[model samples]
Target: MKTDPERFILENTSVLSPPHVPEIRLHLASEVHDLWLKTEEDLEEIGLPPPFWAFAWAGGQGLARYILDHPETVEGKRVLDFASGSGLVAIAAAKAGAVEVLAADIDPWARTAVRLNAALNDADLAFTDDDLIGRSVDFDVVLAGDVFYDSDFARALVEWFVNLAESGCLVLVGDPGRSYRPTAHLDPLATYEVPVTRALEDSEVKKTTVWKFRQ
Candidate 1:
């Protein structure tokens, strides 16, 4: 099939908006425990309006930025970035020298974005679709970001993390303290004041926290 013009434009562009220029120079990794890829222009072309409209969560972006600054966390480890939005976390893991990285998301657009961004950054990532649901894989670390906005989804995701952790995978999550964050199973690891443009359906400027699975 012929590629869509918007997708084509996003694939070829470097910078998307003026504010995004800084992010363009910075690499992003998945905060979710799956495969994710990121591109600067994915949000606009996907029809998401500003802020959340850009690709990925500021929390995820922040975490990726952090990992880039501190590569020891992922170097030589096998990693997974689940619910990989713009695949920022996955990209970060790859850049940080993870031996293997996978970015996973339910959204098809997200998967495409991950592939494009990985190519843009010259990073290698494994991408998976819903076919991997209910399946488990061995990974040293798993990351997630901004995934607790909805109660039901948060609960389910947390449960999955708990299972992963029990299986010996280290799990990490970056949350903006959304209403649905599961307080019981998570322990705060670090906190960040992420600068954000309004991209989500609600609110702007999210202050996020990074947490590790406790149980």
Candidate 2:
């Protein structure tokens, strides 16, 4: 903990809404925020984490949209938002009527960001900085967004998700076609043209899809 996460996030982000999921608000790094421009080296020098929690990613936006639209997916069930940056998807689960929501991420900064964003939306949720990729949990629904960027990480997550799905927990993911996303054991549920900043994505709008993990 080199940086004071709460202070750093407050100074570097603005309260804003992800375009596709405008019903929920978050503390995000906008174009005017230097966080949107800082390179990894710059962030390291400033004692900041990668700051994934500072932006609303396209995959998160699409997943949040789907959850908000299809309340039955989470309503009255315990939900887990894995790799939850900024707690956007977790908040959506709460808003959609989940009885309990847990946002899990390994980044310490993300914990603070999730706290702030959840408070902004008055969405009650819990957060854990533990890496839950290989562990079993007590949630009824599992939602992940934009996690399949690297081959090794993707492989680990896919395996864990498959196990969770087979155990009868509803597993869902929002992906923007990352290179290593699973090619099997998944069923597409919904898709959206998620609006995003070019700084974070290849294009201003990403064609994102929500998929359900199946046995």
Best-performing candidate as measured by lDDT = 2
Model 1 segments more than 4 A misplaced: 1-54, 131-134, 199-204
Model 2 residue 171 CA deviation (Å) reads 0.4
- Count of clashing residue pairs in every prediction: 37, 0
Q: Put down candidate 1 lDDT per residue, 1-215, tens digits, no spaces.
A: 24553464364444432121243332232121111123224333434322222355766866676666667888999998887766777888898899999998776455666776677677888987664434687889888877787777777787788888888888888887778888799888767666664534255566677788975
Candidate 2: residue pairs that collide: none
TM-score of each: 0.76, 0.93
* Model 2 ranges off by over 4 Å: 1-3, 31-33, 36-49
| Model 1 poorest ten-residue lDDT run | 28-37
For all candidates in order, the CA lDDT equals 0.66, 0.88
